[model samples]
Target chain A: MASPVFRGKAITYGDDVNTDVIIPARYCTSFRAEELALHCMEDLDPEFLKKRRPGDLIVAGNNFGCGSSRENAPLAIMGAGIACVIAKSFARIFYRNSINIGLPILESPEAAQAIAEGHEIEVDLGAGRIRNLTTGASFTAHPFPEGIRAIMAAGGMVGFVRARLGVDAPAQPGRERKRSQG
Target chain B: MGMTIAEKILAAHAGVPVVRPGELYFAGLDLVMGTDVTTALSAEVFAQMGAQRVFDPDKVALVNDHFVPAKDIAAATLAQTMRRFAERYGIRHYYELGSSGICHTLVPDEGLVSPGDLVVGADSHTCTYGAVGAFATGIGSTDMAAAWALGESWFRVPETFRVIFRGRLPEWVGGKDLILRVVGDLGEDGARYKALEFVGDTIETLPMAGRFTVCNMAIEAGAKTGIIAADDATREYLKGRATRHGVYHRPDPDARYARTLEYDVSGLEPMVACPYSPANVKPISQVEALPIDQVVLGSCTNGRVEDFRIAATILKSRGVHPKLRLIAIPGSQAVFRQLLYEGIVAVLAEAGATISPPTCGPCIGGHMGVLGPGERGLFTTNRNFKGRNGHPTSEVYLSGPAVAAATAATGKITDPRTLMG
Candidate 1:
């Protein structure tokens, strides 16, 4: 099987950029993707919508999503047209929530440091390869393990679990693999 | 060569003889908690995942606390979704608007948690259960939905960072100061994805309220959970309180840790986090006579009955500063009742405190007393992020209940020790 690689322009941010700024509590009462995307980064960068294009990825400094367990933070980013987030590190819940929602994220201090804002970059989830097309810098990140990779390939935890339950059959207990999306 | 308490609990729940960090395993959940803020979303995800019925109705708990008194039409609808879902599934542990306060305090205060249990909740402060030695961590609603269906969920075991607190706590210092000191030292991301095992002489003598305070803010430093071993004190708290047979797990002295952090609290003072970040901390002695606009003394962080007692002690004969408003909230309904039974509520009211129902109102900027632009408020709650209380230009400061009350009396940040004299 060929490695699944994602490419996008890097939308960068600084360290400890917390959840309140990502999807402020004012918008957190609901989790609809479309509604949250409109307000994503509205608190931090008022022009995030104008600056971002669909399929763009975010590269940020240390501890990207630092506060709040609201999954809206990641979904808002996804809803805003970002494909992946590469950070120096992520708060535990943000990291897990991103992955559970099928949003690919990686931690690479080197990549987080060298990648310039709006630079073109490509990521390979299986090979853990991060290459900056503009700067030509290449760094390796910790890739998802097999189980996590499968879950992500199935388009997140809900879809993954549905595939495991054989598309809504109670007769079979769990762990039956099904074909997944790209 | 041996496991920490967190590792042991996860291994046991996963039905494994042992486990290692960075490895993935499916662990059975002992309890699953949700709130109005999270339950509707998780129920939607649960239905999408084709989960017809919850795996165990008895293990699920749903609370209406975030926008609880039904802030508006939307919040009321959210609560209705959670209630209807609970009724449909026959989930027995549901708490209505008046019955519960916050999910974290309500879960353990009602004895839904016991030592050495593997628990998960939809709120970030779910790590609060670690006070009793349970390996509880927060998950998003989607994960909660998956757990609702499977009674188990996948976990990547986290590395353990054991923080040992030594020396006697100084007068006017409590667990909030110690944890703030740790966060100030560790930085916001210092404990990312690691279990913080707090042990040593201080923890051995600390009260259950203080222990709960310490573990509650593990997330402030980006930790997966903060844990202490279940000792005699834990057993005493659990005696006739916990529903299940609680098993205490001890870490081998030789347990491998990612790192070890030690703090001597003998010289510690009340610590405060200033402005847009919890990691931006200073000892209250260093904080100058900064005036405040509001003083909110509640949330999962410092909203227990003991916290109220300390606040009432300082505010007994004094009144809230004429310039600022003071709001006191108990952590849960039980905590509120205890404060009332002890006449602490009357003292606070006489002191000009606006007593309110138990909810995570202003802590998350949900309602109650939100700050205006250029407004600065002090709170016993955690997270002083920009726009956390109200306006993006508004400011926030954080401390324990003592500093909060002292500040309330003075209209500026003041030390509680000065009030004692």
Candidate 2:
């Protein structure tokens, strides 16, 4: 797979952006990614869903995604077409969930502080380099482990595991199983 | 190098001679729990992964406590999915609405978790088990599914934060105050990805229920887990209840800690976490007399018999404010039975408080005592995040049962010290 570079407009937020603000508990009934995307960030920023563009970047202060262990918080971000998240720091579970779901997140206090809303930022996943086009400034973060980078490159843990196991895509419920016939 | 309690347990589960902080290892789980809201999604992921059967059905517990009795059609359907999965997998520890309580309370009460064991639950409050000296932590649904499939999950061993409480706690101050103070000092994310090892003379003297309350909110500090070295108190509580016995792991005397925090509780006052964040803490004396519309004295954090007993004592001869609605929920069927047997339930009922069955009701905004718009609630539940209870406009103040019961009687946030005097 080729190393990918992403460039997008920044959407900035304050510190301690909890999971409840990203996606409220009331809307957690569904597991479908896109269904969750509709309400993403609705509680904190009502305009997030309608205003978000494909491949938009999210930059936030410390403790981004701090509350619940709901993976939907990151899934909602990805489903809303966010390219990556850059934060001063991230809550532990949120960081792992983002990686498992194939959302690229960089921990760069310098970048988070320098970036502003509507600024165009470019991130090179392989190189760990970030350039703020609007500010004409650049920063670097620790690149993800090669194993983690590969998982994100493949779109997530499920895809990576499926590929490693040499299995077909997840089967629909109604499909006939070879074991049933045997 | 001396291993911390968390490190020792992880090393045992990983089948490795030793493990250090920042090193990743896949550890086998002794127990994997899922609630009604999260189990359904985990089951879907398990099926999607094309796994034939659970690695160990007995090790998994599917609890139906989050939205019991089905608040809505959607909740009912989600619960049904959990039921189907549990039955299909022949999972041994399936507890439905009436038979179950909150996952954190029911798991330990039912002997599903034991000291030195590694446990993972889909709910974030799973760290509650760490009070018993187990290495327990919360994971997402997909991670829960992976554990169900492989009987193991990965972890980066967390550095330990040693918090030692010195001196006796003041009257009316307990675990709730201690944890709130630590969280307030550390900020919400102070211990991110770290293990909080609570130790000291004060911790050793606390009852098992109070210990659970302290560990339950470790997640509030962004901690991976909270631990207390198993001792006589833990052994006595686990007597006849734990499936396994014998040597439980404890931290060595020289175990390395990322930081050490010592607090003296001799002069501590009851604390409250104000609206919007658990980190917004203040002494109850300062926030006293703040009007409140509702009071909830239940959750995995403080719904035990001890907590209810404290509330019942205050409400014994007092009538709750006519304008206020008070709801008291025991942590489990066992707790409810104890409250009934001891007449605590009756005291609460005579005071005009609604006693509900063991469920995560109102804590997760499911039902029974949801707040209305512009309303204020004083609760004993963990987490006061915006819109956590009901309306986004509503505010919640987190407190212990003593304060919650006193507040219910006064229709405001009142100090229990005043009422006791």
**C-alpha RMSD by candidate, in order:** 3.8, 3.1
Best of the candidates, lDDT: 1
Give me the displacement of residue B123 in model 2, in angstroms.
1.0
Q: Provide DockQ values for all models, in the order shown.
A: 0.64, 0.50
Q: Write the per-residue lDDT of candidate 1 for residues B317-404, one digit (tens) a residue.
A: 9988999899998888889889999999999999999988999999998889888989999999889998888988999999999999
Summarize candidate 1's per-residue lDDT along A1-182 as a digit string, tens digits: 46678899999999999988998887777799889999898778888999999888899999998888899899899899888899988887888789889777999999999999889999997677899999898999976678778778777898888987676565433333332321
Instruction: Name model 2 segments beyond 4 Å from true.
Output: A146-154, A160-182
Query: Could you tell me which residue pairs clash in candidate 2?
Result: none
Which pairs of residues collide in candidate 1?
A: none
Q: Which candidate number maximizes DockQ?
A: 1
**Lowest lDDT 10-residue stretch of candidate 2 chain B:** B44-53
TM-score of chain A of 2: 0.84
Cα deviation of B417 in candidate 2 (Å)?
0.8
**CAPRI grade, predicted model 1:** medium
Give me the runs in candidate 1 sitting further than 4 Å from their true place: A1-6, A124-127, A168-182
